[model samples]
Target: MPTQHKNIVLLIADDLGKYMGSYGCPSISTPNLDRLADSGTRFDMAFASTASCSGSRSTIYTGLHTHENGQYGLNWARSHFQTFQYVDSAPKLFNQAGYRSGIIGKVHVGTEEVYCWQVREESGTRDVAWVADRCEAFFQQATVDDKPFFLTVGYIDPHRDISTRGGFGNQERQYGTRVPLLDVKPEDVEIPRWLTDLPETRQELVEYYKAINRTDTGVGLVYEALERQGLLDSTLVMFTSDNGPPFVNSKTTLYDAGIHLPLIVRQPGAKAGIVNPNMISFVDILPTLLDWASIPLDARSSDKDSRLPTSPPRQGRSFLPILQRTDLLPESDWQHHVFGSHTFHEMQNYWPTRILRTRRYKYHRNVAWRLDFPFAGDLYASITFEGIRNVEPPVMMGQRKLKDYIFRPPEELYDLDADPDEVSNLAGEEACESLLLNCRERVTEWQKQTKDLWLYRDGQSVTMLGRYAKDGLQVPERLDFDVENPGTKGVEMTKHLGVDAYSAGIER
Candidate 1:
């Protein structure tokens, strides 16, 4: 391997959040990941921009939000969301700098030209030992090629099977050495506050834990492989999930349960077991990787002609400066608030929403609040959801009622210190109106920067309205037009969200 540059290894799990013992949840066994947390720095305030798989992964790879990158929904099977071709990608940057870049497991982001790695082995197999074997081969190839390596290993365990009732893919299967099938009983699992603790749910959890144990073993196996190759000291390892757990109210929602994920980084020679409290979004991952590789932070990944006059620079800065800090970084040095943008999960799940979260408050803006929040195929078919819907009278989902979950208001505001689960809404209250408006403005500002087309006013997209705004088309400065009056007379019109650049479409 090249002596001047350190290797990079990114391990991402599918449909996982902070469910491990290390993240203070003892319900599931994640010993391998726990050890990684103990040996590296664990970020407690890490987040995903979008809770959907492809959208979140694209955010990590491109250092851009889903709206900015154009991966608005799922990219697999009937859904066709892909990152924009003009975007700068981490793998392409590493490849440009002469590193041996490869992705051994699942590759969710699309358009080969955007994520142009030197080697790509995209697969959906859950046999993690096979994945370890492939990683070992890639390391050896890098050694032969005499270059530092950059590899992304995506684990498919702990995610639901394509078959709706596959029970998280847990079965009487054989796993190789160091991979023990955990004996976690249904009673041993702790039902999250976001879920109902029922018999069917418990039964399904037993299988979910088994899958989690396999994923943990896979992490250990890959670490052992890197150690065997004598690259432990020369590699930068990071482990995180693409999204939260594959359950209702978690997978597709902008609530903390869905977007707040586990992020552990073990940079070479960094202090071990340090807990980092600085807030970070998934968009920062790419810049941090490039920072570690000693590449120019603003270096263009490619010079190909773009649809836009110029490709947008990454929205986030690197966390390398504070990666090893145990204390909370000051607000001036790091951002205290985190933002989330979720457009869709499956094509059918089109409840476009934006969220702004600070330490004290959380605000959610549901653009299509009238739509009875659609479900991802897996979540709708899950045993947990089935139990929630089929049970006797007084149907409720955790502390929230089932109807409340299905039908939501246009805006929701919660005091996080009082309601971490975001059950109580204050958006409609008179006293909280000031805080509500402030949060709404902040989220709208974020949408404009990302060029989000979901910014709706008067029941229409602001981006669409911008195309005709210069021609004196009025975009009423309100969520929806008043049906009783049915006129724009004396109403304020503004191009607050989509202005100037958006007037002629995103082509500019």
Candidate 2:
């Protein structure tokens, strides 16, 4: 394997959905993620900030968004959102650029190990032989310590059929095809009329496509243990998914199947069977893996690692020229506006959503005067094992009242070109009320240039969480919530289940 500093492998597949067969989803068998998207580049507009799962990996290892990365939800310190302190993540900026940063399975991220060299807790989906024997002994201990690495291998198998709302079972579609479930009917199947579609939601999507064909054969056994340690053509194999899927309105809802995912890359100077339709996010994977190992980003690390600290500018922008181009490079200079936020899901209730997606529009701004119930109240109440097997109301008592069919919405605008299943509502479509008021004033000036204007406040203002909770304290249970329901019937059941959870997010 010809050398160079570009050795990195980021593979996540929790709620993965850009439907496989290299993003065309002819129905599942992701032939080694379609040969890693035909050996390189396959984005088709990637997105994810808050579709839950620690607000989409705290906006993909802190490239911001998820309200500046406070992690906006999932007990990452209680979460009012603000991140960068998992010891300055992004594999500690590839371990301060000298590289060597491993993580086996489901490092849900931000519990903290500060850019992991080791955080092996395999079981995001029936341990798959303990993550293929702990990622083949963590790449044979990072190629016998000649470490120029940045490995991440997480798989929670089709996020347990999208957290048990179900559909994607009987495995085998690694690009060979046959996981179908778009307009339901495998026996009255239902679970997203804002929640609750049973027959075990199609037997939990056929055990989530048999855990996505057993995490694509554990990502072809970690790409054959990085091609038997030659580190697969100098690594750089980034496949994705942390949000989107986990049923209902798509993991903690920010829509686009809860944060449109599936972004392939593969490496060896990239550029193989390409297709990079721009609009990437997850905060540009730590300055594109610190600009492919040349590193540098530190800029006095604050404001969650350079969203701004002293000319730190980087909310992500560098697909290295779309990994050598497949065309889609213009959302006015490639930074395709995308932002999302959703603090806590399930129980301690926190619904702070603010998203603005592009590639034909999607804007949702519901600053929680309360109302966003898909799987009812705070969702993802993290008890795991499929949230105690869908909160076992007698092990499946009408999908446990399908959380009384969630309801919530204060604003929503979708037009993914006449709705890419975002099901109508151009925010009161009067010929797109002046393009939804200029996408809500460009999402309130990108939430006041990232200071997140109290998420466009109107209620619950502790004045910027007490001016960033005194020096933006990053972890003490992050944003620690135990209870805070100021009611209005939980804001009218999160807006009467926000348009039937956006028309049961017509899956893919």
Candidate 3:
């Protein structure tokens, strides 16, 4: 049979983690997502490179880490971080391949030049039906133009609003209509293992779950619209979240609760209802979309015969092969580990962290371990935190001391097999020394390769300093700095290379 060009619809939920009914969150109602999962492949170990909204979305769009993409912090904040002008975003790539790309809501990644979407609706409403209506219009336009379309519908559901009182803000009306909200009882809420089982926590979860249900309705509306337009079978639909829920130790952190996202991909002419346990990163989304559409990454440069360059080398490999296959590939063939780099979320939240996670273990290198980890504005004022702060001695949330959580060590290692909740710290333990060293080395290597600025200790980037040493020493290759034990051992060219020798803006 001849291949058919597939339309793409990507649905991204803000501040949602693996808390859906499809992912077996026993209490939260997500019938639409559950049904979609039943008809598609569900990825068990999908992770975002960063837990911050813009950074994670930029990674998804460009298939490059936050460090490489230059969107290190929130786009909406004063930080005004955006993707590099040289970077090729997902919409630009898809547009090059004759796809009419549109983003419905929360286009939070960067400047318009980088994204360059044909249609953009930047509404902040939590109304799923309203957003779905916009999706329907985009699909209709695609049909009229006779072009396969790529649409990203970003939902602001399940994220705490600006209200001082903790709530998901699901009650806000859009287009003079509101989807009937679900009444989620606090008693019925199944609190995640990472959060404390307090009354305030449960009450907050009730609001979160209600917002999720509303998001589910929005998903259903989009699906129905596709079906009505006879594009359901021709569209490759994906549902995922930007990061984990907006709370302490989840939204802005590098732990599993933060980076581990829910991924469901339903491709046309592929096997359905399969659960794949392969580890996939947000960076893989671009390459996967291109592969699925049978569009080459360098299609524009090759076809136009113009010097228009292709995107810089992608960091992620396409998983479309596994998506099409019926049987799950061996663990060896699949990506076994994922890396994360988080520099900032809001303007004030400057706790930089790097993480490496495998099936059995996870390691975190907290760059600013000495400083008290600053909280995202919403989390600090949360009802859950309200409960925690009022208690004497300050109740710990999920085996994490309020003090310990804030004043973390330089390194943290957890045996995920034994302690899935990631409560135990094995970094300083003698028994786990080798594993910690290996993880540190791997993460540092990645940082160097990506030219990560967060590879810092004592406010100095070891990677940058090593580069300066190699340049001054006139070495053939760059020298590796001992990130684990900084200043202990490395190419000692500082005596020969003065601070004046290094130029500003050389470390990007």
Candidate 4:
């Protein structure tokens, strides 16, 4: 019934927030996820690089941010937001190492051959039992062949159904006895601080809770499958979500409600009941898995083409060393800050935002700040949003005004210790000038490293216009173009944040 082969199983949820009991949510108790946390380490400050579904998943697979990986939006036939053709993904690296790699749901990322998953049973089914059955068969096959496996089980629950404003895809189908649908009412839920506590929001939460339960059941079932195969100890399992819950202020935004996620790792023979407080990123997922699989970092890019040799390096290092620790990692041992990149959700949703989030502060640079923030198609159609907009003039989305949510400034800085909800803006304040500048420069350096096209100066992309400097062309050293005094000469150029070139980063 067992082989001691090292294996990896990544469990990804569709659109989930940190709503489990383990994360201190009082609304719904996620017993399965709580049990999972009890058996392993639950990271307190895990983050996704982007908030969009495909974009976030791309970051996890390729260990690069959305801007760096070329999946800056949803991957659809019409949207065409696929990963860059030359990028190396997790499955390819595992498959190349003679490991059987496969994904058993929601293959949303790209051209089929590029991900290179050996068995791709793509589906949108929310049936946890059926999904576990497929995983059980997959494990059985791997056990028979005595080959190590890299499996990704993507769950499609807890995400709002785009077909309607209030449906969570739980109305039409029966998920059987293994997955007991929670009988919830509008009155039974406590609304999140990120959403307005309206009747519409409460009504949607009833349906949302049922889907969350199904996701919890799926996690339990998948783990049970591993137990049945006696591969529990040999396998390293991970559970996380693509982004935050599907709400107006949560899903597609770079706010904490969006990118701040739940990441639990059950490494084999690791200490149980560990609470790891290191700031981890979704970009580190592939590297951690590769490390656990004993695959060298250089083993990737072996398939690099000479014609397309500009493969970006993985922006995250492996967190394998810190995954089993119960104590908080020191700043030197683990980074206390994480960066975020978001460009789009739908094709219409194209507001590019780069973010720098530390333990105390958050900085956001909205490149398309002039444009009114666009909403995702499903989010806009939601009954909760409908209720918010069809109300009084000063409608509130959650605790913040709807107008403030729609119209945003180019830069936003927040002291997270004072405002964890990120409602206050400090970028325009005189007292926060030094802090704002520090955060802005930090994000800018990251954008430069990721080669982000949205890192613009004087309203123009700096990298896109790099070749024009030899022609005596000098752009203004400002964020936006100056129409009043249009003089590029004698005005100092906005140089890098470093005192000199060749330095890694600017210090205070």
User: What 10-residue stretch in candidate 3 is worst by lDDT?
Assistant: 496-505
lDDT of 2 by residue, 352-393 (tens): 768788878888777663564535332343222254355546
What digit string (tens of lDDT, one per residue) describes model 4 on residues 328-368? 67887788899999998899999999999998999999998
The pairs that clash in candidate 3 are none
Model 1 scores a TM of 0.96
TM-score of each: 0.96, 0.35, 0.90, 0.96
| Predicted structure 1: clash tally | 0
- Candidate 3 global CA lDDT score: 0.81
Per-residue error for 297 in candidate 2, Å, reads 2.9
The local distance difference test score of model 4 is 0.86
- The segments of candidate 4 whose C-alpha lies over 4 angstroms from its true place after superposition are 1-3, 496-508
Best by TM-score: 1
Kindly list the per-residue Cα lDDT of model 3 for residues 1-508, writing each as its tens digit. Answer: 3234489999999998988988989688889899999899999989999998999999998888888788888998578888877678888888887788899988898889888898989988887788988899888878877888999999888778767478788655432344778877889888777777788998888888888888888999999999998898899999999999888878899989999999999987777898988788998898898898888854432233233333456778888888745454677787688889898888898888889999889999888787899888899989998887666786687667778778888888999999987879998899988998899888877776666766653456654555456554322222233557554335333221222212322433
Candidate 1 ranges with C-alpha deviation above 4 Å = 1-4, 164-166, 306-309, 495-508
Give the number of the best model, judged by lDDT. 4
Taking the tens digit of each residue's C-alpha lDDT, what string does model 1 give over 264-379?
Answer: 99988989999998898898899899898889889786666745544576788899999988787788888888888889888888889999989789899999898999988888
Using alpha carbons, what is the TM-score of model 3?
Answer: 0.90
In order of TM-score, best first, we have 1, 4, 3, 2
> Number of clashing residue pairs in every model?
0, 53, 0, 0
